[model samples]
Target: MRIGELARRSGVSERSLRYYETQGLLQSERTSGGHRHYAESAVDRVIRIQTLYAAGLNSKKIAKLLPCMRDADGRPNEIATPTLVNELTTERDRIDRMITDLLRSRDVLDEVIDTAADGATTDPASLARRR
Candidate 1:
């Protein structure tokens, strides 16, 4: 397919696809007139690229990881080495911490909601008077 078709199918912008190609996260072939041509699997590749970006991975990291993804040909290749494994691990830990923090915030909000529902004024002055 062409770039526009790929962009439409993948729900990614044409500029983003071009940027991905420039960043080496995606590959394309040039036609006789120099127009870019992408394989059908390019749609899926774009989706994966968007997913990694949404996961907070940078373009460079996604470039390193993209090679591990197989093309339609099904050839096996390893993209990330041992060094990247450490980075991935660190990312995972950071994600875990963010999740924990979000849960804590949610708990606090829930408590506030419960207090309000029970008609409790949790103001410092009210609490002092109650004590």
Candidate 2:
């Protein structure tokens, strides 16, 4: 399909698709007239790329992970390397920490909301005293 069709199907912008190509996360062929053409499988590839980006992986890391992923099932292939595994583990750990921090922040916000709902003092010093 063409870039427009890919972008529409994958819910990603054409510029993003081009950027993915430049980042080595996606592939396309040029026609005799220099128009880019992509295989039907490129749709799946774009979806996978979007998934990785949504998970907070940078383009470079996504590029590394893409080659090892099975397009059909989106599972890792048997080409695991120690370096790749380590990097992925580290990225997972960072995301875990971010989740933990976000949860803690959410808890604090919930407490504040509850306090406000109770008609508690909005003044910081008075609220601290009431607490």
Among all candidates shown, the one with the greatest TM-score: 2
Candidate number achieving the greatest lDDT relative to the actual structure: 2
Off by over 4 Å in 2: 73-78, 120-131
Candidate 2 has an lDDT of: 0.87
lDDT per model, in order? 0.86, 0.87
Query: What C-alpha RMSD separates each model from the true structure?
Result: 5.3, 4.9
Which residue pairs of candidate 1 clash?
Answer: none
* Residue range with the least summed lDDT across 10 consecutive positions in model 2: 117-126
lDDT of 2 at 90: 96
TM, every model:
0.78, 0.82
